[model samples]
Target chain A: MSVAGLYNYWIVILLMMTGFYVVISSGNLVKKIIGLNLFQASVFILYISMGKVADGGAPILREGITHYSNPLPHVLILTAIVVGVATTALGLALVVRIREAYGSVEEDDIHRQDESL
Target chain B: MIGTQLPALQVVVPLLAAPLCLALHRPFATWALTLTASALSMLVSILLLGQVLAQGVIDYAFGGWAAPFGIAYRVDLANAYVLLIVTTISTVVTIFARRSVASEVEAHNQGLFYTAWLLCLTGLLGITITGDAFNLFVFLEISSLSSYVLIAMGTERKALTAAYQYLIMGTIGATFILIGIGLLYMLTGTLNMLDMAHRLITVADSRTARTGFAFLTVGLGLKIALFPLHLWLPNAYAHAPSAVSAFLAATATKVAVYVLLRFVFSVFGVDFALGTMPLALGLAVLGTIAVLSASTVAIFQHNLKRMLAYSSVAQVGYLALGVSLATPAGLTATLLHLFNHALMKGTLFLALGCIAWRLGSVRLGDLKGLGYRMPWTMGVFVLGGLSLIGLPLTAGFISKWYLVLAALERGWWPVILVIIAGSLLAVIYIWRVIETAYLSKTNKTAGAGEAPLSMLLPAWLLAIANLYFGMHTGLSAGIATQAAAALFGIQP
Candidate 1:
């Protein structure tokens, strides 16, 4: 495949890897959650891109339309977006609790505190 | 009508009850509703299992939209067994939760706890039963979200960190699964598992399909607690409320395994997924390391709950081992272990919950001489521990025997040695607890009595099940073999 042809997938992979790295390497609890959201967003982009067809419009009933983007991935990603929102809300809530308990959200601080315990 | 709707009702009951539980501010009423809903789902699972056995796979399409267009709840021999395991454990844990939750959670938060518990159950059951790949992701998120909440509710503040860690790992896993499913949909243009299976056979060698398979395995590996990706499990289990730990230990990973089985054998075809790739051998190596390393680490844990949590990761290794064998006997052993391990771990965790109920801690030091103080509870723990050690006349032995037999069939004698060594490690860790509880002298100052009957009954119920299923393997082994055969495309 040409670079132009595969550029979309390349972007998706790059975004996903960056998000995964941020999650694994970040000490800040909130940063890790943001990384998670980024990772999921990359997946959403990949699905939506795959759904697209050349010169296609929204998947709706049109008399003159010959091609339409695949709608299934869009529907599936809609559900996934909701799941992502729920996860973010829950993650933030946990971070709040962690901050309250440890007085810090950094992984290093939590570890140090726990070790002292 | 009820029989016809059993598959949908199996998950829907708990799903609906979760909202009801949250809305009902009365703590007692919520607990009662959660318990009743769990029991009802368990009954539905039993009926579903019977129907699957007698009539074979039951396919129920949502809104009568038919497969490939709408989602389907497909109950074959495999997932029916899983559904039974999930619901049975949930029922037992719910029965035990009333007293345990009352003690661990603040009175006002009790309703929310029960709500999350039921939602988790619904998510697990839904993941086990759905035939649509996308539906599986939705259900996975439901269960995972609820689990984070449940773990966060632990009495200890550490539970928050554990819950956060789990949320991060679980979301990553779910995202990878979603990516895999999306790739498969792109390749096959179908989301229904059976349709995907049919479509995939033609393009099994395609690069996209191969990439999708890899993504699915790694993604699920994280969720299934497969060795290296299992860092989240120990803390999550060690710090969650006892009832949540028992419930999750007994059910969540088992359902994840069910999903792995569906993808490997049904969607991707074993020959292409395992045979073409070295996936089986790779999994076998990872499983061996998981078993050996986790068991060894478990031996050094000062906290009893953490030790058991490590042991759980080791147990997951055994499941992965069975999957790696990639034969009917191997699959059978995996399925049997799935059921057996749930019984052993459920019983052991519940017993610990009993101790936690009476003493407010499960530290090894705190448990000294509990043999005299809580003889019945400790006795149940002993039986459960023996099962964990794979001793004769316990549930653990039955699955271990099958695993050994499967390894021998493949002439993989080193795996047999690995299994034996793993058990020896289990013996050491389990014996540590026994030594602490039975051999050490009791601290007479703190007047701790036996755990209440409500707690004792459920723990013993599972303990007895461990022994009974070991002695009488007809049900578990029979269905497991049938499920394996079905996976291999054998009609019988």
Candidate 2:
């Protein structure tokens, strides 16, 4: 395969590394969650891209359609999407609790407060 | 009629009860529902193990869909062993949770707390029982999200931050695993683990397959809290309420270890993972480091709960060391320690729950002269502590004895030395509690007395189990050896 054939994978890697960098570098709690979302989104894209077939129509079989993209990855990603949403909601709920308990969502502030205790 | 449905029911019992628990407003009602679910699951797990030993691996296809197309639940000896461990610990901790949760958690929130705990149990058992790779990831997230909720419900404010940090770390780990599974699905075009393993053979030498393995290893290494990726463990264990601590500490990581072994030896095949990849030496080196560093760190902690948390990490190191050996004997040792560590840590954490119930603190300073005030409670603590240190005639020593035997067979002299050093470190940390409780002046008791019979009975159940299993190794060690041989695809 030519380098041009791997375009989606390059984008996947780029988005993944960028999101991972934000998650690791950002001290703000909400920002880290956003980065985690981005990281997961890249994986969704990777999965979706892998399921495509050249010149394929929708997975729904029709008269005269000789090819179709795999639908299993789509189905799998839907479940992953649901799990990702649940994780985000739970994470944000914890962030709300953190803000209430430590009076700030900044990592440094929470650490100092816990240390003082 | 229900005999054949054991695999699905092992998880569904807890999954269905979680929502019912959330609906029940009374704390006691929710606790009863959760206990009922775990007890049923434990019974099913025992039957499943017996069935597995009798019939070999049992495959249950969902919705009547066969494997390679529909999701399946396969109960081999290994799955039954892990399922039994998770269900057993969950059942014991559910029994231990009534008073612990009432005192530690707010009354209004107890229903929701038990709901999350039930979901966590569903997830851990589901992960161990499923034969589908994608299904395992879903269950992993289920357990992790519920654990975050459970951890955030701790008594101290720091629990909030601990849950938040774990959420971040755990989510990243889960996503990495999702990517790995997706890659495997792309190459094999099937999600069934056995089918994937069969398909993976011809493609196993590919770079993509190798990348998938690396990703899976790192993700699971995070889940296992292996040495480098272990920062999230101590705080998560230390800050959670004691019942949650006991249950999660006992089951979650052990389940993760089972998954790791399954993916490595079963899915990837031992040749691709350990033989081709140099994984044996890498895991051995990291396991050694984790044992040395985590054990040394445990001795310096002032909080007894946090100290035990670090010890949990070191115990995980022993499991990894056993896996690194890549022999049937080594795996048997790992399996034995998996159960033994759960016994010791479960007892220790439950005992700490009792201490926190009475004294309202678990710091080293609060333990001063506590032996005289709560003799039975402190006696349980001392026995748990001795087991943690792997003293003779205890469950902990039985596993360590096997671990040393394995190392000696492998001619890993340095690992043997590390094991000795790790045990010495455990003695120092455990003896600190004993010395503080018995030898100190009697000014720091806080006027507390023995915990309720309800709590003491459950702690002693596990403590006595530790001694019983230690003396009669036939059941624990015998089954572990059989399961280990099966995993290695050899005759016991």
Candidate 3:
């Protein structure tokens, strides 16, 4: 398999679609957060893949090497990863608060209880 | 001195205020600091707007780094207008929150509330000002995380659940947006928006660019609650505390709409977004559906806050409708409605906050006869409601007028008909509240007196401004027209 083949992007897209499916289909709120994390992780992978240079080692500035990986995409992915982590943490916190208040993590059950009220 | 630092100060003032609020710890002291910080940021935003108007555009590279290499803060006519709206709303809402927060949020949590409010303000302003695409994502998370915390601080037990729902949906939206940014960077090898715009023009017809554009549009569409993707909004708005409701209603979605505009016109260019794809027609259909369906749903909502939430969805439809027109007049209409809706809805939500403070519930049954007791508060609500319905002398009317004109300009009379029909539906929902408050003789609201002066002042100020701006459309309309024309690279 050649390194420049499109397999890496295919895997990333698969992971992203799976994560999206879980987020949309799952009834459990915690599961949805997990799915969101996976979805973001897939995006990070995509960014890292785009930054890859064929036959090039690392992105460090070397004296002899004529080509190096794109550093801009790496930096952007790092910031995006931080944002993803922040969103995950906030989502979990909200989930804990929701469980405390509603006494359930299932979306359907919470809606049922709210409707009853 | 301040003129040079205006761009940085617009964000730093609120960012620094969060820590000061935490250090103070006392509720009153935190409130005072937050208000002062918001007012200061508003002052800086005003100065920045003035500079942008006079000097064409202001670009400040962070840490003195040049553009396309380091992050830059770009202030053009479009973003300066948004900055003014965000900062001005924050200033008003912060003052209102001082009184409104005491009754809704717990005492110990008040400090944290102010901190989160400040952070949210900073994030919103930062998102509007930043020129780097990745920086926009970072600031978006700052705002989203803080907004989740603020929404959870509501007194109602359901607020936590609402916040959780918002968190999940917001995370999905953010992830989509990050992916879009990643894709764009993959193709262009840069994160700067202007640089990306320049690069995108060269490869405008590539499959990767088209896919990237689709992701960005859908992601922002979800954030701005464009029609079917707006499920998270009504619940979040309905269960959150009054102050949170007012702030988010007025600013958050407006900022998201601005982001959509930035990408559609500035980043991707109008030719690709509005011409290459059927996006304009699709958006026009969705906007019309959202207007009719959301308004119909709002008419049946028993809770005043929930009704207003659905109404907000309908108002978003109007903005989307303007964008769908894909003409300079259409963009101007969208920008105008963005400002007008912020003022009208902010006032409406603030008036509801006053009612919630006194009556402890915003359900229509509980609000019967409220007009008799809290005459001033109810008067503000009525005025806001009239504006929501697009009465001739309110801010809403001006936006609708321009939207219809844009539609008619393109010979799309069906869109004009939909606009009229949507406003009629709006009249129905607004009438529901009016009838419940005035004509009904229920005894539930017998003791509901007027709200405190602190609350009424902010609410009435926005309400009066609605009428004032509606009658005199010089400032907002002029700025919006110029901004919209600039967006299309045309002179007005």
Candidate closest to the true structure, highest lDDT: 1
Error of 2 at A11 (Å): 1.0
Please list the residue runs of candidate 3 whose C-alpha ends up more than 4 Å from where it truly belongs after superposition: A1-4, A62-64, B444-446
lDDT of 3 at B207: 84
Model 3 agreement with the true structure over B1-492: per-residue lDDT tens digits: 757878889999999999999999999999999999999989898889999889888989888899889889999999999999999999998889988899998899999999999999999999999999989989998998999899988888788888887888887888778878877887888889999999999988988888888888888888899899999999899999899999999999999999999999999999999999778987898999899899899989998899999989988988998999899999999999999999999999999999999989999888777788888999999999888889999998999999989988999998888888888988888888888888889665446568999999999999999999999999899999999999999964
- Please report, in order, the local distance difference test score of every candidate based on alpha carbons: 0.93, 0.92, 0.90
Give residue B85's error in model 3 in angstroms. Answer: 0.6
DockQ-derived CAPRI band for the predicted complex in model 1: high
DockQ value for model 2: 0.94
Worst 10 residues of 1 chain A by lDDT: A1-10
Q: Estimate the TM-score for candidate 3.
A: 0.98
Worst 10 residues of 2 chain B by lDDT: B441-450
Q: How many clashes does each candidate structure show, in the order listed?
A: 0, 0, 0
Better of 2 and 3 by DockQ: 2
Note the B-chain TM-score for every model. 0.99, 0.99, 0.99
Write out the backbone clash pairs for model 2: none
